[model samples]
Target chain A: MFKPFAFTLAAAVLLTGCSAQSGAETQGGGLADSLPSLTGDYVWTVNAQKSTVKFEADYNGAFSADFSRFAAAIKLNPDAPETGEIHAVVDLSSVRADDKDVTNNLPTPAWFDIKMHPVATFKSDQISKTDAGRFIADGTLTLKGISKPAALTFDLKTDGNAATADGNFTVNRMDYQVGTGSDFKDESWVKFPVKVSVRIEASR
Target chain B: MSASVKSTYTKTAIWLHWMIAALIIGQLIGGKVMHAMDPAPLKFELYQLHKSFGFIILALSVARLLWRLGHKPPALPDGMKPFEKIGAKLSHIAFYILMIGIPISGWVMVSSSPYIIETKIFKLIPVFDLPGVPRTEGFNALTKDVHEYMAIAIAALLVLHIGAALKHHFVEKDDVLNRMAPRIKVRR
Candidate 1:
């Protein structure tokens, strides 16, 4: 489902305008946090070996895969998470699925279209701490040349200097045309919703 | 000659025989079509169906083999030479091997694949992968090649199997084909 470039450009602008307005409102009022130890402005270094970004595609059973290469830039004083930003970039070409066919199909035009869109990026417009002591990052995910609203909710656990954040979010593959067109339009073969889970181990 | 009498197959045996035959034929064709097509959602669906039918064929083969063990099949038609009898027995053995081997190899191929895809029969029945089977590229490739070649072997065997049956019915004018034939009025 290739939307015209001109039309999508206009839509992108409109979506961005809405996100910015909502972001401002959320940031102005949502700063309540209870995790005092996590309240710091230190730039954490992600331990690549310990971090994993995986997505599951439901077919017969879930066809699970992980992006071998991904990076996250998180600036946060967990006590005032509203002022922080969460930016993540995943190299889609580095996706490895447990099924060879799925791994091969992911880069094709009907799937991730890696040749055209090699990287999927998420930039948070607003970050907030929940009462349950978890954090949520409201962001725009740019994937396959299309941008859509996405949110990542994570539980941040700090051990002295090291921090581990594990979270999961589901995205409809149909929205970004990840697995659309031909027979994939139906949910029979491969389901539409792809659950993306992330574990980031980082230290200041 | 008394050991080589002709008799119609039992109804259960005949049913399992024909059901497996029909499913095997479908699986063969589906396998070929799916292998030749480019990777797409339809191809994926075909692959799944192929696996489902493969499992069905394997299960029916097991049942047929078990049934055959308990209930003796009609012996070879009278007037057949010793060599012919041995050939028929050996061919039947080979058929059983392929019937079971092809599907198992396919199962192993999927199981040992580095990209862990769960096997579900007809998208309804969830089948687990071979336990303790390490997921390795080499193992997966070996099993894949074995599965494909065994399927080809079965195809070749089918030509001989069907041709021999046809020969028995038309050229030899024997009850060999009719023994397994569905609802043939064998007036002896």
Candidate 2:
């Protein structure tokens, strides 16, 4: 087997400063207010060259993004797997979402501007399973000064040797004030059903 | 009779020829089996071995080809048919092309893959030197596809050559077999 070098992401952390301060002024300590007791590092690699976003999401691109920056830990009963808890932090400001100029354009005012607010974090409240055996983790996603409830569907498996988890979810940028810097079609909107996947090994 | 053919082959030359032949066939078999296997660490390891042997084939085949061309092979007995000579030359040309192509293509494909861990064969000599290529998510797939198709081409040519040789030996009572099979004349 190949060695799995892993780490978790905190949206590369820069955005975390401004957003954490904003959340303290409003929602209080951002996701720190609701933390998951899990501890383990998870790596998410995002190849903007590999990622594609459309109004309609495709599942096969249900892939991973490298987050050599952050880690995660989970607490769930084997008997009541549905009652699981997990948390993930991404260097929201580290947008591997584009290369060079495109990247700068994306994390700017009209988009996910990492300049003013750089960190985006998530904390799960409920973890349940579908009839088809996939996981649905519902949580609050905190970015900038906004906290919104979002759910991610994960195909997760755990064994004594290692654990793997993957999920893809799409949400509109407008809901998070991530909009184009324009007027006319002001009702105009672009949603990024950002595809995300995670694979990690736990040491204890 | 050619002066080179009158004398028997040197042991090293003979060994190099048969070894190249045997390993090329072995590499071909390994390539076929590797294709059917699922993607796993073990499967990847098998492919690594196949390419290692493939490099050996290229080297030995080159030696054998040079020895054959410079040292003329045993001539056919008097009155050999013209088509038999033509067939022998065509088959050899096909074999040489494939022997060189298969390994070169495999090396290129391996070099292009980002997932490839070790480029060394037998812990010596760097293999498939083209780096900076991503095997899993980029241009490597196209070369792999071409390598596979060309393997089929080589296999087809091999079958035709073997079948024709067998026909000449068992059915036609011709000297074609005697030229390559050293012991047949003694048996007759």
Candidate 3:
């Protein structure tokens, strides 16, 4: 009876040990230990000349627009990415398209409704390093008074004192009440996904 | 063949003529209505469709011109006066020129437009801008005026052409109208 009890204890210990080892390999470390921390903070100012927010939407074909008027506040430490905070505000009235008609319609009530909601904003709550040279910002995007969680994955390249972040994300126009009750309401005419690309150059 | 019978237009010419006529009429109405509407997504889409149809008309006009060069149209009714025959010939020539000119001018307006949008035919075939056309507000305005006026001229000429055809059919009671009719029998 003692031998059987000893074997059961040994088997239990062996199984627990194997599970612990596999868990470590999968997670790299415990949740608390894996959490990133900030080392230093740097103030970043956007270079307007080199920064632009571009959006693309599909109808019968693909159409794109560029918004030149936007502001970004980024506080980041390359060594400790967890402390970074990024906030951006885009002026909806500044949207411009290659076609004059499309440009004119962008700010109308059926679309961006610049008269009511003139600005779209994003505030990042957390920033985490996903891989080498890449980071993800978990944030809330508020447009047309509706706030929703959005994650932006971007690649950061720093050249001495200057840094550039290029990233892209997609949002459903319907979620923001844009293009509602218009001919664009039908997905066949205008698709739901509106892809937004960002190319921002900032300096300390 | 009976002496009283009249010759008819060739099948290719007949089809081209009718197709171009229908498209031109539709485009004229669509263009005016779409332009008058306030800027919206629907208006924008309609403009694109109008532009695509304009390009199609341009292609058909080129083919019609080639067909006209190789094949002769049926002669005017012998009862027509000398001046009437000359008028008919001049009008037909004017029709051909305007049919070709309207589309080309519209194309020039689009090419010179300051807005750098791609013109896709039926949202499928991509059309490049005309070579050497500067994309500037002044240039586009000039081309737009030309395009609009030329379209008006085409519309006026169409009214005359249709009225004359109706006159020939009802008043003159001749084969002038029947010669281009869809299913009218013609002598060889």
> Chain B TM-score of all predictions, in order?
0.93, 0.79, 0.94
What TM-score against the true chain A does chain A of each candidate get?
0.79, 0.59, 0.78
Q: Which digits, one per residue and each the tens of the lDDT, describe model 2 over residues A93-147?
A: 4455312323334555555567776656666777776634356667776665577
Model 1: colliding residue pairs: A98-B115, A98-B116, A99-B115
TM-score of candidate 3 versus the correct structure, residues matched by position:
0.55
Error of 1 at B12 (Å): 1.5
Q: Which stretches of model 3 miss by more than 4 angstroms?
A: A1-204, B1-6, B184-188
Estimate, for each residue in A55-112, the C-alpha lDDT of model 1 and write its tens digit.
8778667789987666555566556677676666676777888986688678877788
Model 1 stretches with alpha carbons more than 4 Å out: A1-204, B1-6, B184-188
Candidate 1 vs candidate 2, DockQ winner:
1
Q: Fnat of candidate 3, please?
A: 0.00
DockQ of each: 0.04, 0.01, 0.04
- Distance from true location, Cα of B120 in model 1, Å: 1.2
Give me the runs in candidate 2 sitting further than 4 Å from their true place: A1-204, B1-10, B123-125, B131-138, B172-188
- The candidate maximizing lDDT is 3
Per residue, candidate 2 scores C-alpha lDDT tens digits across B46-80 of: 86688788788878777777877777655654555
- Residue B143 lDDT in candidate 2: 82
Docking class of 2: incorrect
Assign candidate 3 its CAPRI class.
Answer: incorrect
Residue A183, model 2, lDDT: 24
